[model samples]
Target: MNSKDLKILNLFKFDENLLISYSINLLKIIIILILIKIIISIGSSVIQRFFNKQKQSKFGFNEKKADTLSELLKSILRYVMYFIGIMWILEVLGLSIKTVIAVTSVAGVAVGLGAQNFIKDVISGFFILFEDQFAVGDYVEIDGLSGFVETVGLRVTKLRDFSGDLHIIPNGSIVRVTNKSRGNMRALVDITISYEEDIDKAINIIKDVNEKMKKEFKEIIEGPNVLGVTNFSDYGATIRVVAKTEAMKQWGVEMELRKRIKHALDENHIALPIPKRIIMNYKKGETNGN
Candidate 1:
């Protein structure tokens, strides 16, 4: 062989042992990844079992508390496992774990300096869970956005509104929250009648309908009784009917009250007020005439 050809062959020389070593490392990595998956799956099931046991025990943990804790624990477990997996993969690639930690510590400080809001969000999220501010399936109004809470994560909270829109809100931004699912809600239905109608008769009719509704809808907790004349408008005098209903049932009860009252009033021939307008016409040289 020529000298140049020999040099080229030397440069291209293959190390079979080195290749074998690398193949083995690759296989080990694959095995590690598979094991991580299996371990995580098993760990998740174990965590669920633990919580389920807690729920059934005399510990007095409600379903909401159990569910919330389960989600948070699962999330923390997944993150820890992924972090360990990443470190192991780095080691397989012949990287120094101590050196990686030192570098990451420095980088983490730098990131922490710039990510104050992220830290705040995480802290607020923890407080939200601990304080029982609200839970999944609760209807709440936060910063004027009202919806059912879907998930409360470490960094964000998700809400699904009535129209099926999902809103993702940062935890730190939820300053004021109005929880509507905590107690009974008020259902108010105002019935207006003409000035000429017998006010007592209308009130009695509404009371009758209210009595019937109380039997029909078990959600009604308190009276749908007439509050007497609540308002006098140009169109009519308003007789307000107020009822206290179970949380989330108020709207439905209010709608049903309106329908029944309307039917009752129509059957009794109680005239609902109609709008009236007075028009005036004036000639150029004369005063106004109606």
Candidate 2:
């Protein structure tokens, strides 16, 4: 062997203690990682069991509240475990945690600046849950995105609109929320008739239809009674029909009410005005001569 090659081999052989130390450190890290997995598994199981028991208890929270609490617990436990595991791993590698902390502090500032939106998203999501602004099954309009909430998460809110579009919205972006899932909703339809037709007779026909509708639909919370003479024009007077219905059923009730009213009016010979226009013309050559 050349002199340089022999020297290199001797140097490595002389540093056997360092090599062994590194090997030991790596082995410890692996063991720590395995223990972390075990700990996390046990923690997760315990959390689930505790919540499950609470769910079964008569005095405990309801299903929705229980589920939300369980999810929060799981998230916190995961972060705690991961943080401790990383710290232990660094310690086993003979690294200075104090120095690492300082470095992380600087890194954290940079990350925080870059990830403000993510922080806002998490904060907003927590407020939403805590305030009970909306739930997973709620029909809501958030920042103009109208849909049924499919999932509420720490960073994002998922919604599935009526058109079958799935929207993944950052909770931070939702400033104004309109929840349509709660309480009763209003359904109004304007029915127009010929100006020549008797308003009272048309109103009577609508009232009869409303009476039949009330009996048919248990969802109608209030009258589908006609509001007289909502508007007037050369075409006709617009007769307004209004009802209060259970949430999400407003559209359905409105549609059915419209159909029924139309049928009733047609059957009763109620006239609907049609827009008419008159055209008058003079011969161009004759007019010029005049």
Candidate 3:
């Protein structure tokens, strides 16, 4: 072999004691990693079991809320387990636990100064969970975006909007949340009839249709009563119909209500306001002057 190659080999010549030490450290790290994976698996199962139990218990949270909390806790547990494992691994590499902590603490402070937004997000996430502002299945409007809550994380909240787009929003930016899934919603429809049509007759026809609608739509919680003439448009008087419905079913109830009312009016010969075209009969095309 060349002289340079011999020198490189001599520098790395095996020391039995040093080799054994490093091998032990490497084995210890592997064991630590394996234990971490096992513990995380067990931790996740426990969290799921606990939440599932809560779902059955009347005293605990409902299914949606329980699921949300369960997922969130699992995420936190994973982070904690990984942190502890990393610290242990560092100690196994001949670094003093105390020295490592001291170093991380200093480094953490430096990172913290530049990561104020991250801190705010975590704090806000905690409040979101504790205050019960909204849950994973809730339909909510936040930051002018409306959607169903998909997942809630420590740093971000995901929303799946009606258009199927997923929005990942930072928790800290959520100052106001409008939850639409909490209580009953309103289904409102404004129907305009021709000025020639009797308002009282139209009102009665709508009320009759709504009576049958109550039986068909289980979503309706309260009256789909006609509120009488609310306004006068260029074509007719606007009659408002309003009903209380189960949350998230308002639009369905509204569309159905309109359809039924329209048919009912049509059957009773109650004309609705619509554009009418005047056709002039002539041998050929006629001009406005003609």
- What do the candidate models score in CA lDDT, each in turn? 0.88, 0.85, 0.90
- Which regions in candidate 2 have their CA more than 4 angstroms from the true location? 1-100, 284-290
lDDT of 3 by residue, 1-290 (tens): 99999987776675666788899999999999999999999999999999999999989989889978987888788888999999999989878988998998889888985588888988999999999999889999997999999888877899999899999999999988999998999999999999999889899999999999998889899989988889998778999999999999999999999999999999999999886555665866763421
List candidate 3 segments past 4 Å from native. Answer: 1-9, 12-38, 92-94, 234-236, 275-290
> Which runs of model 1 end up more than 4 angstroms from their true locations?
10-60, 274-290
Better of 2 and 3 by lDDT: 3
lDDT of 1 by residue, 8-99 (tens): 77766656667888999999999999988998899889988988888898975776677677766776777788989999999999889898
For model 3 the local lDDT of residue 27 reads 97
Decoy 2 TM-score against native: 0.69
Go through the candidates in order and give the C-alpha RMSD of each one to the true structure. 4.0, 5.9, 4.4
User: What's the TM-score of each model vs. the native?
Assistant: 0.81, 0.69, 0.78
